[model samples]
Target chain A: MENVILRDVGLRDGLQLVKAIVPTEHKIEWCRRVVAAGVPEVEITSLVPAKIAPQFADAEEVVAATLSIPGYLPSALIPNARGAERGFALGIPKLNYVLSASEEHNLANIRRSTQASIDDFGRIVELRNETAPKTCLAAGIATAFGCTIQGEVPEARVYEIAAELCGLGADEIIVADTVGYANPAQVKRILTGVMKEIGDRPLLLHLHDTRGLGLANMAAALEVGVRAFDASIGGLGGCPFAPGASGNINLEDAAFLAEATGFATGIDIEALVALRQTVETWLPGERFAGQVAQSGLPKTFAPIHRQAA
Target chain B: MENVILRDVGLRDGLQLVKAIVPTEHKIEWCRRVVAAGVPEVEITSLVPAKIAPQFADAEEVVAATLSIPGYLPSALIPNARGAERGFALGIPKLNYVLSASEEHNLANIRRSTQASIDDFGRIVELRNETAPKTCLAAGIATAFGCTIQGEVPEARVYEIAAELCGLGADEIIVADTVGYANPAQVKRILTGVMKEIGDRPLLLHLHDTRGLGLANMAAALEVGVRAFDASIGGLGGCPFAPGASGNINLEDAAFLAEATGFATGIDIEALVALRQTVETWLPGERFAGQVAQSGLPKTFAPIHRQAA
Candidate 1:
């Protein structure tokens, strides 16, 4: 867990939520700061039709900027094989292939059924192998906990899809609670079973605080040996897939939790709070999320664990 | 758990964080609104020195006003036996007792050692038995998780103090993550052990999202069958006890999580959100917390568990 990598997705996921369109160059600058921070990985942009998400119109440019930053793992989201192809062509570090587990969510979010999306995932895997062998392919099964279109996603279905994603040659399999309905016990229960089937695929926990269980679910996953987590800087990206849900785990809060406890994720809390100042200036209309950043550290704060030892 | 009482400490615990003194009448009016919203229990005020917290200088008067509200189980903080006497005379339904678990925290917060505080608890218990027989007494083992002053508070000591409190005739024990240093696993491990020693005395979880594990802790406590919780509206209070930590668990977020995870806390999410508007007008500078308040409910948001039974 000490080696866990927290990828800051504020540039892509954070920017995606703003109603006001950020300039492509400003988006590039967002990528620059995150890359400069030397976070092990970053989801720099989400590739979609420009009209739906104007904030991410310059996905190509954002990926290109990330490509320029060495030692930073640049990644982007692709909705289909086309998005996957575009991402692979960039010579970036990773491509996140996302699909909603609920059939209702897939139809509403991507205008495809669950199986259709799974079929497309096969193309994505093939695209990665043919076009970008070095580019890591991670499948994010969104709404793994439950969905807005269809509530209470079965644990067996999530486990089955994870196994299939692994069989399809996914470099990593991420179990996401898109609507944030998972409790820690439920997270522990599901992940305990899911890990058995997924074997050794680097399982990622993509959690939302939609129902205030983001960090709890993450903790349960960590207890079961999950070290890879996907979070948004300033808890940006309320939701591209679900309307009323989008804020990922706030990077600063997660860092504080991880560092305060016995785990290590090399996130500087004060620096992360500083990063939110930039985000505040960029996304003025959008309300930033997190408690530690707002309330500040405890007066008698003791950092029991060392970082990057 | 649906029948379990949730005590809102927004007025007493929440308001002290903001330095700006809200007018006494306005604070009183908000207390009325809180009670009208169907909250069964509320920690309306604390009997600390007025000089230290002028915001709560009217705690006695506030308790008087709170007791007037029909069916309100009004509670107040008494640092020692004297504060309990004041609350007892007022005929309030509950008297909350506090003693810090960390030796340094006890000194800094209440100017007492662990043994001395325990001795005081015995005296307070005796006083309650002699005078305030009608008042429900709850002893809070503050900083049971960890402390800013002494750092890691031992689990054995926490369990011992909980048993001691129960033996001293405390009606219920409040386990607080004062510094927000507790994670989900720790919350579960500690609360489970404490419950065993204390028999059936109800355990109330008082959490702060300071380090973003408050809700995570709640989920863990839920696993251990400790149903009741303490939250403040807009996550009020800035660790006046510990200093520089996050506020209490925002009531709206806690209610949202409780309902989302198939548990009913009997809080109206929309009503809770509406309640924050009143606070915004009063304490504008104070950073009130909660994510669900901003995001609203998921489109697929259905309280299936709440409806089924």
Candidate 2:
């Protein structure tokens, strides 16, 4: 394990954005490729209703197939207590629960009020503690920076939510720029404030490249001591709720950034680059954006994992 | 004027890579529109031979037309002493002279050794001092980070060259990732070393978005107190000499990053966004890469110039 973690959310986040339903076997293969590329963790699929997101109708099968793969942590996005129950029943080791920081976004996304979601989140935590003590529960604060529906989300509200989630037994907390509305200054400010409010807790960041600040925001967060980030392979995933948001920061690019900035990610970038070809073939005509894919790795770049091996 | 400088190099750098030769009138209009967008500086053209870079055939005419526009400092790329003489004769205010930090890149780029380029740079400085005292001589250290030809460039060589330029009475020193081979760690490391060696001199940065670290590299440079950056409108310009290189960082996105990070760029982002349309029309079929153009400015984004006004 390296000091930094790149949690690949391509299957859950990436697939949900695409209309075409990728075969469950291909989703399983995607997991295997990323893990073989030395990614330690992956959010394999989301336990959402099949009707709501038809692309992820085979989430259960994906989780089952991915869990059989060795040497990688397979996780899933649990939208509510029901999803959490399903994941627990399936014996998944990690469940990422998301709640929007803005009330409007929460209402629009999950059709629930902010307080109602928090109450449900607490129930999910309790269920996790009772049913699967070994499972890690991560609370993701979506739209933590700003929301398209509500415009500017106050940093105070984000900090308060972070404090609340920390108190509510979230083993990990993630600050997300859901609509890609964050800049480096805002990222540094929010990360610093939330870290001050909840001392020494494991914090992760999920940034969208909607306005091209994804890697720059990552650099700012790294400057402020953030070591974990959520990324989607081939830069997949966009906010269907947000009007003009782009996609998640490219995982291979994010891993390349981390490693290039001297943070050991244990990711094999060449393998990730190769996997991108398969992804391209799987989703024909879908545009994938990343620089390493076009320019290849710098000659000076040496993967720490390869060196160790 | 704002605290940060977004010197648009689109006309010079952007058009140079483009195969189509845009009319001189359109090039002049590009300069005027960018200036109206509140950019403080623009590199309007390059004084290179017409046979070598036919796209810049009207360099002198473009400079003559753009210098008539007020508010923005009009500059040009001066490849050698002859080009410097032409720019000075045209009364272009700033002449950006390129010299590669790697000997291999210098020989390949300009058919001269690194030491010869330095000597030519000194001659250009002397020529400006004796003939046109008002013309600012800027020494651009290309491949300051790494080179496609030589692979990894030693930081000491960059520092040595930067210090030499400062000593030789160059008005400005620019560290360029000519092939876009830089990561943030290398950026911070190189910038710190050069700044320490050449204390308190005006240092600018020219970053290529070749591998998509352009904005990220810009943020790293900004974190270490670098304020001036070279950007191309619509992410234009790839090195005709270097293989596998992309374009300069996009000016609109660069301005967006600067303003969002609380640095006052004085750039009217909306105006710039509109100008991108004109650029697209001017260079039809050319692919321009930037996020701000794809996703309009965030709701909370307030242009610093608009705020000050």
lDDT of each: 0.77, 0.88
Quote the lDDT for B144 in model 2. Answer: 90
**Model 2 agreement with the true structure over A109-135: per-residue lDDT tens digits:** 899987788888899989988989898
What range of 10 consecutive residues in model 2 chain A has the weakest lDDT sum? A300-309
In candidate 2, what are the lDDT values of residues B1-309, reduced to their tens digit? 338888998888788778688988888888899999899899888888989989888887887788989988888898999999898888888889999999999999899899999998888888888999998888899999888989988888899999999989888888999898898878888998988977888889999988778999999889888889999888998888778888899898999999988788888888998999988987888879889988999887876653352
Report, for all candidates in order, the number of backbone clashes: 5, 0
**TM-score of structure candidate 1:** 0.87
DockQ of 2: 0.81
Looking at model 2 chain B, report the run of 10 residues with the lowest lDDT sum: B300-309
True contacts recovered per prediction: 0.58, 0.75
Model 2 ranges off by over 4 Å: A306-309, B306-309
Query: What DockQ do you compute for every candidate structure?
Result: 0.47, 0.81
lDDT leader: 2
